[model samples]
Target: MRVISGTARGKRLQAPRGTDTRPITDMIKEALFNVLGSGIGGASLLDLFAGSGSVGIEALSRGARQVVFIDNSHNAVRVIRDNLNNCGFTQGFELYRNDVFRAVEILARRKTKFDYIYADPPFTVEAIFGPLLETLDRTSLLAPDGSLIIRSPRRMILPLKLKSLQEYRVNNYGESTLHYYRLI
Candidate 1:
């Protein structure tokens, strides 16, 4: 995969050699950035289930001030670091090899807030989706005006509203779907 725009435009990124992770497609990445537009600039991003860190890397390339990548796989973490170095993005990012829920709790304890938070959990593991959403709501991890974007199978149904957040947009990309949420 490659970065679609900004400082690292067209730079290639390496993914894990196995099927342990699913990377977002170029088309979907482009569309996501298009939807984000200038709002990404200078924003702080949190990338949960970061995989190869493609989504967070893209955000950094497009001028996000800071990005934190979280993933459970060791191979994924290594690949993300290599990709970051490849893109010459040595600063403004962090990588965490931990489960998403644990990462969330830790970040919350640290009082971290992100302007943009992105999540792409495994499609088959549907049980985590609701709890994840509720946890995000329970912790003030998302800025009041910030956004949380989730990628899931198109057929999967997620909550329309959380305690402090509400789904404002949903975009379908064939088999995958992007859900956008904001604080209510």
Candidate 2:
């Protein structure tokens, strides 16, 4: 995959050597950043299920002040590290080889807030969608005016409203869907 825009535009990224990780396609990534607009600059982002770190790398390329990447897979973490190194990104990022939920909890406990949080768990793990949303809703990890963007199979139905967050936008891209939520 390649970065679609910003400073690192046209930079090719490497994906993990297996099907365990599903890196976001360039088209979807482009559309996602388009929706994000110029607000990405100077923003702090949380990338859950980071995989190849494509999304987080894109945010960094577009001028995001910092990005925290979390993933549970060893291979995925390695690929993410390699991708970051290849892109010459020496700073403004943190990589965590941990479960997304636990990582979020730690971030919350540390009072770390992000301007945007992006999650793209494996489609096979349908069971995670609900609990993931609930966990994020219950935490202070998301800034009051920040957004939580989830990428899921188009057929999957996500809740429109949580206790503190509400769905504000939805975009469908082929078999994938992007759900945007913000504080109510």
Clashing residue pairs in candidate 2 (N, C-alpha, C atoms within 3 angstroms):
none
Give the number of the best model, judged by lDDT: 2
What is the lDDT of every predicted structure here? 0.93, 0.94
Prediction 2 global C-alpha lDDT: 0.94
For every candidate in turn, the CA RMSD to the true structure comes to 0.8, 0.6
Q: Quote model 1's TM-score.
A: 0.98
Task: Please write out the lDDT profile of model 2 over residues 102-153, one tens digit for every residue.
Answer: 9999998899999999999999989999999999999868898899999999
* Clash tally, candidates in order: 0, 0
Candidate 2 deviant stretches above 4 angstroms: none
Question: What's the CA error at residue 46 for candidate 2, in Å?
Answer: 0.2
In model 1, residue pairs whose N, Cα or C atoms come closer than 3 Å (at least 3 residues apart or on different chains), thus clashing, are: none
> What is the lDDT, from 0 to 100, of the residue 176 in candidate 2?
98
lDDT at residue 135 of model 1 (Cα atoms): 88
